[model samples]
Target: MKKVFCIGELLIDFVAEKQGSDLSKATYFTKKAGGAPANVACAIAKLGGRSVFIGSVGDDPFGTFLLDVLRENRVDVSLAQRTETFTTLAFVSLAENGERDFVFSRGADKELQYNSAIKSEFAGNLIHLGAATALLGGKLEEAYGHYFFDGLTKKSFISFDPNYRADLWKNKQQNFAKKCMTFVEKADLCKFSLEEAQLLSGKEDVAEACRFLHEVGTNIIAVTLGASGTLISTREFQETVPSIKVKAVDTTGAGDAFIGCLLQQIAALTNTDSLAGDRDLLVSMVAKANKAGAITTTNYGAIESLPDQEQLSA
Candidate 1:
């Protein structure tokens, strides 16, 4: 199977132990290795798929911990960088139902410098742009654009997930959506949360939103609807696959798990011709991905909650 390349931030998430929306009132925080891309890479690795993570962390102990977590999970970290700046930190506040609010302290993640040396690695593989901070600007943004075109030129399957976070954007939300659309236009596969789909397409209906994105050029679009399930759309197929029932504790890594599983399955396929035309196969893959995601919610933390092949089969 071709390895999935995940590019973006690798940081520490300080999650509140108590379930509530208030971060200020929470007296305790549990640190975990977290970042959308890093979580996806770890998810793929845990499921017995090869994955490589490309991002930056600080030269601090927190960065060391994050790298160790990735390595332990079997994700390749050869391309990961260490910066002099402090590692990025996100404070997560969770509601009783697993809803989360985040406050970010931008750090080394934003300092990721562009390196053209890795461009050849994009050839004939899958590269997932899962960054929440990559689009926010700086050298990471430059790297994102450079690698995206390189992947395209090399006939790579380009996947993108904007992984939109409101707190991170603040007043720059419009810029986020606009910049994300550029990626949406070029991506072979794109994943979006319900809110992100609506905001980007300016459509109330999920189908219409997906249609707008399709018109903009993404060959396949998967819009995640928190509890309902995931809506998947391509030129020849569209369907809403229902989610598995589970008692969700933390939803932080659920979406990552779903996409990771889906991408892994896609990467494992020897016959790429069926990917666009096989509706039943696609639905089945999404169903399996749903189960993977559902299973993730039964546990706490991102990487820790991710299921292995045996766990997924069970």
Candidate 2:
């Protein structure tokens, strides 16, 4: 399999136990290694893929713990950097149905500097850009833009996920959508949540949303529809791949798991350029990715919930 370079934030998520979507009321909390790209890296590594995590964390214990978790899951963290800034953190409060409310403490995650050497090494590999904190504006965002353009020039298979967090954007949803379009317009594969698809594409219908996104430039689009499964689309065809039934404990990282598994399968392909025309293969990959997502919902913490190849097969 080709190497998958997952570039983004790596943070500590403080999840409040049984808290009903109100961070103000949450008392008890547990820390877990989390971040959209970090979770994707772990998901790919856990499934026996060559996964590398590239991002910055604080030179603190929290950062140490996060790196340790990635190493334990077999995710290559050699490119992960440490900075003097404090590690980023998100305080999450879960509702009864597993939905969550989040409050963020931005920190070292925004400090990832662009490396020319790293950009040069991305040639002919797979690159996943799925950071929630990336667009918040800083060195990370600059690095993200540099890596994306460099990947394009190097013939890397680029996948993008606009990991939207309403809490972080506040009243700037329009601005967020605009920033995301830049990536959506160039990515080989784009993954979006139902909400992200609607917000970014300005279409309520899933098919219409896919059309809008494809017209912008993405060759492949996957819109994750919670329990309804994922809507996989290409210019020629679009279909909803079914997900396995499971009582969701927490929805966090489910989408990451889905896209991670999908990318892992894509990385193993000899020619990703033909992926858009191969409907049967696309459907097969999405079906397996759905299983990975469903399995993630059966447990709590993001990285901890990811299933291995043996578990995926069973």
Provide the overall lDDT of each model, using Cα atoms, as 2-decimal numbers. 0.89, 0.93
Candidate 1 lDDT tens digits, 1-314: 98899999999999995459788778789999999999999989988898999999999999999999999999999999999999999999877788888999999998887788888887878999985899888988888888888888988888899999988888987888899988899888898999999989989998999999999998888888877899989888789999978888888889999999999899898766558678898888888888888898887798999988898887
Each candidate's TM vs. the true structure?
0.98, 0.99
lDDT tens digits, residue span 170-217, model 2 = 999999999999999989999999999999988998899899999999
Model 2, CA-based lDDT: 0.93
Worst 10 residues of 1 by lDDT: 269-278
- Candidate 2 pairs with clashing backbones: none
RMSD to the native, candidate 1? 1.0
Q: Residue 288 of candidate 1: its Cα lDDT?
A: 86
Candidate 2 deviant stretches above 4 angstroms: none
Best by TM-score: 2
For every model shown, the clashing-pair count is 0, 0
